[model samples]
Each structure stands twice: as C-alpha cells, then as structure tokens.
Target: MRRQAATFVWRAALAAALVCGIGLLPWLTRTDPALTVLKARSADRDPTPEVLADIRAQLGLGDGPLRLLGQWLGGLWRGDAGRSWISGDEVTPAVLQALGASLLLMAVALVVAVVTAGLVCARTLRLGAHRRLDGRRTAGSGSAVLAALPEFLTASVLATVVGVQLGWLPALGWYGPQWTVLPALALGLPAGAVIGRLLDDLLPGAFAEPWALAAAARGLPGRSIARQAVRRCLPGLLPNLGLFVVGLTGGSVAVEQIFDIPGLGRTTLQAALAQDLPVLQAGTLLLVLLAAVAAGLAALATRRIAGPALRDGALSSLHRPQPPTRGIPTFVHGGLLTLVIALGLPRDPLALDTTRRLQPPSWTQPFGTDALGRDMLARVAHGALDTLLLALAIGIVALVAGALLGLVARVSGPLVDTVNAVPPVLAALLVTSVAGSGAATPALAVGVVAWAPLAAHTSALLRQERAALHVTATRGLGAGRWYLLRRELLPAVLPPVTRHALLRLPGIALALASLAFLGLGAQPPSPEWGLLLAENQPYAERAPWAVLAPAAVLALLGALAVSAAGGIRRARPRTSATLAERPSLTRELVETG
Candidate 1:
C-alpha cells in the first residue's frame, strides 16, 4: 500500500509539473502571453503597454507565473479550464472534444497494431514449426522494413497512393469510420512491426521450454503450442504495449496534420503555435493524465497476466532480455541507397531554377527537383549528413543516459515509464512552445522519450542478470554493490543496451523528420528529409516524384537501422534459456515421461 501510494504521488507530481510548465511556457521562454494573446486576438492592432497591461489583467497573468499556475489549477479542480485566448471559447469543451477524437483514433490504431503484430507472429511461428530455414530470417526482414518506415512518410505515401491515386480510402478529413482507416494504418503499421519483432524474438525460447516439449509429446498441435508461447511473451511485451498506446495517442501530431484530423495532437499543436495557454494547458494536462492512466492499466494487465508466479519469481525469465542481431545486410542496403544518392549529387542543392521546378526524374536529375527547383538528389545527399549525424548523437545520448539511469531501476522505473509515455511529437510541442522550433528542438524532444526504452531494456536485463549464480557467489564473497555493478553488471548490460540503441537510430532520424515535417524541426529550404516531404506534400498531386524520392530514402534508412541491429542470424545470448542439446524426440520423451 505504501509503495502504491508513493507511485501515485510521483505520477501526480510529474503531471502537475508538466501542467505548470505548459502554463508558464510563455514566461519561461521570455515571451509575454498578453502580447501573444493580443496579437492572436487582433493581429492588426498595435500592442501598447497600456493595452498589454489590460490584457494581462483580464487573463489574470499580472500576478506572475506562480499565481497563474495556482489559478489554472484552482480552475481545473473546479472543472473550469478557462477560455481560449484565440477563439474566446471555453477551453474545456474544445479540449474534451479533441480528447474524444484522439481517444477513438488511439483505440482504433491500437487494434490495428495488435492485429498486425499477431499476424506477423503467427506466420513466423507457423513457418518455424514447419522447420522452414527462413522463418526468423523472413519475418525479421519484413518487420525491419516496416519498423524503419516513419509514421509521417507512411501517412504521406498511404495518403497519396491509397487515398489519391488508387481512390480506395479517404486521404483527408475525420468525418466517419472510413476516415480512420488510412490514419490508423499509418500510425499502426510501423508500431506493429516493432512490437511484432520483439514478440517474435521471445517466442523461440518459449517453444524450447520443457512444458512446450511435453505438450508436443502429448500430441498437442503446433498452433496450441504457439498460442501458449505467445501468452508467455505477453508479460514481456505488455509494458511496451502501454508505451505504444501512449505514443499512438500522443505522438500522432504529424498523422493528424496529414489527415486533417481534429484530434488532441493537432489541437495541442495548434494551441502551442498560437500560444493559447488555456487550451494548451488543458490539452497537456489531459495527455499527462492519459499517460498515468495507461501506465496503471498496463501494470494491472501485467500483474493479471503474470499471476502469482510473478510475485514468487517463477516467471522472472519471461521478463525482457536482449536478443542479439546481425548487421551485414543493413550495411549493404544502406550503402546501396547512399551510392544511389551520391551518384546524382553533382548539382548544387541550394541552386534553384524556376524553369526546372517539379521536373520529372531524368538522367541529369535522378531524383527530380522540388517546388523551388532545388535538385532533389543534391538536397537528399546534403541532408543525409545533417540528419544522420543528429540521429547518431541522439542515439548515443539516449544510450548513455538510459544505461546509467537503468542501473537504478527501482528508483527510476516509474519515472521512465511516465516519461516514455510522452510522445516525441508531444515533447516537441512542449519544447517548441518554450524554446521555439529549431533543429535542436527535435533532438531535445526525441531525446526525452528515446532513453526510456533503452532504460527499460537495461532495467529488465539487469534484473535478469543479477539472478545469475555467479553474481550471488561474488556477492557472498563480499563484493560491494559498486563492484558488483561495475565488474559484474556493466559488462553484461552495455552490449545489449548498445544493440537496442542501434535498432533505434533509424527511429530517431524518422522522429526528427516527423518533427521537421510538422514545422517543429528544420525550417524551410533546409532539404532535411522530413522537411522536404512537408514542403513537397502540397505538390504531391502535380509531381509525385517530389514526395516519393524523400519517402523512399527515409524508408531505406529505416531498413538499414533495423537490419543492422537485427542481423542475419539470431544471436541469442549465451545465458539465454534453451532446451539442452539433444535429439528432439529424446527431449520430447524425457519431458513427457
């Protein structure tokens, strides 16, 4: 009871901190909310000091940030979210409406993601049971491809190809059930791929268990065994399932924008951009609440799924542990893409010719030109350096931070889970609101959540590794905590954490691009991949190449990262559980007997 109370207090504190931060964003950023509100209310009107004073007084901001936060909190307790500075309407209703839309979208997207993950896992298991040499290999490749593709790029391609070209689904708007399809898929597929890959990785060990062997010996079907294996993998995957839910709901800003959906992501982004403090605060508060709720539910679900065995430590092995992957294919694919981009980079990226604007791909301009007549090939080539470097830096930072923090998992677990729930886009929104959007904003925003996954992975692995007999023996010999952590733990933890970080590099780049696409990252004429996609989107109908070129490149980068991290062969850890080396029939007989 005390532990639960402490956890609740921590979550509440974090949520309050987030709300206060949002409320005070203007002041923190050195921007006067009165002026911002005045400008938003009447852009044409000159804001004299007297007028600013009047506006500040009207909004109850003359008392400073502390008083403002107190007033907002007081109002919030009374169910009054205040009024929007821009629309002059009640913030509560608008926030609620947006929340409803976002919830519905998140629910649908969650279903799609789960279904996609299920199908992928089923196929892999079926093939593996059949002794197909390519079971993991095939699934790994497909999942890597899907996981590497960024949400914004996926939304754009789906919008353009499926919604526009194929005329199958509505590419724009949020009116009916039909409108949800493309957006849900865009949000779900890549997420599903990630979840599916992790689940697939966990299944092999489950299949090699004595119970599984006994079941097979007792004439249980492959399908039933696979089902049990999935159930075993569930405890490991559920925590991340909560994270994904939060991500789908929170990080969906770009998708909502692309589809013109009036969800919380878009609403919060709009409020942030307009400096609508009331609406922004309400929206942010609600998101933080959602995170708290999601975390609680996930914990409940984990407990339920794990049952009493979890408390007894009987199911400890089912918890997260790194599955090593290979990288040759990743390099080959990445190199090919790089070579292709390099081959057509003779032209200056910044040099423009109006006559050549939106030109089709040709021998001279391999990837064609954008709206401004800047050579796409040259732009992509130049942008690669900036994008890749930033991603690498972010990955390294996340890895180091996660590793150190993960060592104190008991203390940091709640914090990690809570922060992990804040989507990169939402983080970008908050950061951009205070710091203003720039190249660094995306890095800071993405860095906030990127560390959580690695941290969680490390925490789980640390828990698993500490149970080793060698660690216990060393500790019995009077090895201090520091020595155990340094000589014993660090060596085991760093490699897997590094590998997890590698898998996440493409995602970091994609997230940066997504922010760029949403006007929260690199600005105009920058040619950063996401920015390029954003700039070219308006011209997608007239010149499809403008969009496809960058999208294709981003997709390739994703594939490279995923494959590099995953590798050609499953590199299960030496300590990982597996059936003893013996004939399958003999093992089955022994287990059954």
Candidate 2:
C-alpha cells in the first residue's frame, strides 16, 4: 500500500510538472510577451527602451525560467493564480467565473449526448439480425458525418438554421437557459455520434455472449437483455467518455467564440491572441488539471464497477496487437475526390460582385454573397479543394516520413525514443518559426507533429513482425533484408498504415482549421474553411449566410471523410468472438436469477 501510494504521488507530480512545462511555452517562444502586450494595448504607440524595460519588470521578465516557475508554484500553493496581463485583474476569480459557464455548457452537452446515444442504441437493438446490420451501416454513416464536422462549423450551421433563419432561438449571446440549447446541440451531436458508434461496436459482441443467450432462453425481453449488455460495456465506455469530455473542453474554444460565450476557452483564446502570458498560463494550467482529474475519476469508476481485472485489462489493451480495420471502398473515396475537383475547377472564388453584397440565398446567388460581395458557394466549393488537398498532403508526408523513421528506429531505439519525447506542438512551433507562414506552413507544422505517433506504431509493429516464424523461414531460404522487408513485412504493415491514414484525415483537417483560425495557417482571402470561420465571424449577425455556407461545406467534407473511413472498417472481417472471452461474473448472480 505504501509503495502504491508513493507511485501515485510520483505520477501526480510528473503530470503537474508536464502541465507547468506546457504553460511556459509562450515564454519559451522568440516573440517578446511584454512587447506583444504593449503593442496590443497601445496600438500605434511605440514603446521606448525605458518603457519596455518597465513593462518587462512588471511581468517578471527579469527572472529565469526556473525562478519564474518557482514563484508561480509558490503563488499557486497560496491559492493565487497571478494576475491577468491585459486587465491586471486577479486570475482566480475570472477563471472561476468562466469555468462555471463552461461547466454549465459541458453538463448540458453531456446530458444531450448520453440521452441521444441511449435512444439510438435502444432503437437499433430492436431490429432483426439482417435489419440490424443495415441499420448499423446507416447509423455508422450518420455518426461518421457528425464526427467529421468541426465544432465551429456545426455551431454556425445550427445558429443559422434554428436561430437566424427560423426565429426559434437567438443567433448570438448567452443570456439565459434558452441560450444554452443551440451550443449544447452543436457540442452534443458529435459526442453522441461517437458514443453511439462505440456502443454499436460493443453490443454485437455482448449479444453473442452466453449470458445473453441464457437471458433469451429464460424468455426475457430484448430490451432487458440489451440493458445487461450495456452494463457489461460500460467499463469500456467510461474511459472514452472521459477522453470525449477532454476533447469537448478543448473544442469549446471555437464554439464559445462563435456564440459569444465568455467561457475559459474564449478567455484563453483572447489571451493567446494578445499574448497575455499570465492569463494564458493560468488557463492552460487549469485546463490540464481538469483533464487529468476527469481521466483519473473515469479510471476509478471503471475499477469500482468492473473490478481491477477488467480495468487492468482495458489499460493493457493499449499495447496489445490488434487487427487492421478496413476503410471505405476505393471507388467512394475516388468519387469524393473527383467531386471536390469539379467544384473548384470552373468558378473564380475571388471574383467580387459589389452590387450583391450581403445578399440572402436566392436563385442568382445559391449560397448568397459575403460582406465583401464574393459568391459564397464558389468560395466554399474552392475552399473544399484547398482543405482536402492540404490534409491529403500532410497525411502522405507524415506516413512516408514515419515509415522511413520507423525503419531507422528499429536499429536505434534509444535515439528514436528521445526524439519522440519532444512534444508535437513544440516541434510544430519550431518548424513554423523557420518555415514562416504561408499555404504550406500549416501542413508542415501538422505533419511534423503527426509523424511521431505513426513512427512509434510502425516501429512497434516491425519489432513484433521481425520475430515471427515466417521471417525465420524466409531467412532460412536465404532471403535478403530488402527482399524480406518487401515480400513479408511491407504487406503486413500497409493495411494498418492505410487505415491509420484514413482515420487521421479528419484530425488533420481539424488541425489545419485550428491553425488557420489562429492566424498561423492559410491567410485571408484564401477561402480555407478555418480562415472563412475567422474572417466572417464578425458579420455573423448581418450576413449569416456567409458564415453558414462555409461552415456547412466544412461539415459536409468532414462527414464524407468520417463515413468513408467507418465504412471501410465495417467492411473488414470480424476476428474476435463476442462474450466468450470476457471475465466471468460472480457465481451468485449466475445461480440466483
């Protein structure tokens, strides 16, 4: 018990230290925080050396990294989170206030997601086996579509349809209980899709179990049997729920900004823009802590409900060998690609029509005109090409580079591990610093960061495959290294790599959009989905169509990608038996009822 306590303490300390280190990232960058803050607040006014020195002193710039960290930690221990650089207000009070709003939003979203997932699961389970399979495909496709769209795009579309177009809700502002509905729906739909899909995957195996058969033999209703299956799957689902919450919290940045909600995500984004280090650091620390605590709670709940054996098994499954899930059909992927090209080929996205500025949707302007009088449909269509092309390029580059690196790492394990230890965001920032921002910058940043995981997975797989009996037999036949790799290893690796690439597409798109939203990706007038969201946000009230059109396009593309990937996975042959291998339950329950 003492040893376990010590281990827990060490882990907690390490997590805290890692979060603190991340909080120091803004300071570690080359840009001067004091200068940025001064420039943002003062506008055209130049800060002389004396004024700059004073500002630096005020920000504790004279201290080294260690000293600053120590001081910050000390203050934190005393219940002080320092002060905001922009307003000079206490960080704790502001953070707490913002946190309350964010939590409220999150709670609503969670309830919606859970209820929606439950209904979908219950409805799907009622069908006959053949009908269930068809239902599963349709549900999978719908979930994939929802999962593909980013939060900002979803929020914009919801706001436009329900709030602006139909007068059911206000377009913007967080006034009362009614205001939470749209944002919660926006957040809930994607999360619900994720949960629904997870349940879909788990239910089949559970339904195949002995217990399910026994329950059926006893003449219990399908719903009762389904409830038992759901309970059995809950242990697996809880950890994913925690991760979804963490992701939702992070994704709330764009959602909060679009809805004009004063949540911590919006506050952090504002601080990032202004380079308000104090507020940014505090916000980062708070978010990191929240994620860690939430994850820990999930683990505890899993252990309590499912016992230590199942909990440990679930945790260990991370390192276990797994089958490659197939991706969408090749013809479908090709068709989508062709469609994007056709949309972008003819129309000039940048051509202005000053006479039709901010026009509503009509026959003349299908998606209407933006504030700048650019045709929204043409720009969105063109933007699809840009977004898809960038994401594909990043995926190809990351895959190829990771494969080569994985080969090298098989020989130099320690060196690869050291390089892999560097945070992807830091690597991205360093690359951006050297490459400078442009059309290629976002891809470069995201690719460099994304390659590490692929490389690690590949390296591990290669290590396992290299020791297989077939490799030994090939060696006995005097097969060379290149020949063995080409004939044996490459074939084994390609399927998983392909699936990983497909799974990675949506993430790459979101990353590109995020960077573009942050002004580090595609610049204005480019029609990139993220850029459109950022640029057209201000005119959301007057020209709702401009924002909604691009958002819809983004969501549509994302859905296509997700659905395609999911279709491929579903097409793969099933390998594992359902409930036969699960840990047995208590004998009392088995014998009693």
Best by lDDT: 1
Error of 2 at 405 (Å): 15
State the local distance difference test value for candidate 2: 0.64
How much is the lDDT of residue 519 in candidate 1? Answer: 72
Model 1 lDDT on a 0 to 1 scale:
0.76
Where model 1 places Cα greater than 4 Å from the true spot, the runs are: 128-138, 164-167, 316-328, 344-346, 433-438, 461-496, 567-593
Residue 115 Cα positional deviation in candidate 2, in Å, after optimal superposition: 2.4
Off by over 4 Å in 2: 1-27, 119-122, 128-140, 157-176, 308-337, 351-378, 393-504, 518-520, 533-549, 566-593
Give Cα distance to truth, residue 476, candidate 2, Å. 28
TM-score of each: 0.88, 0.72
Total residue pair clashes for candidate 1 = 2
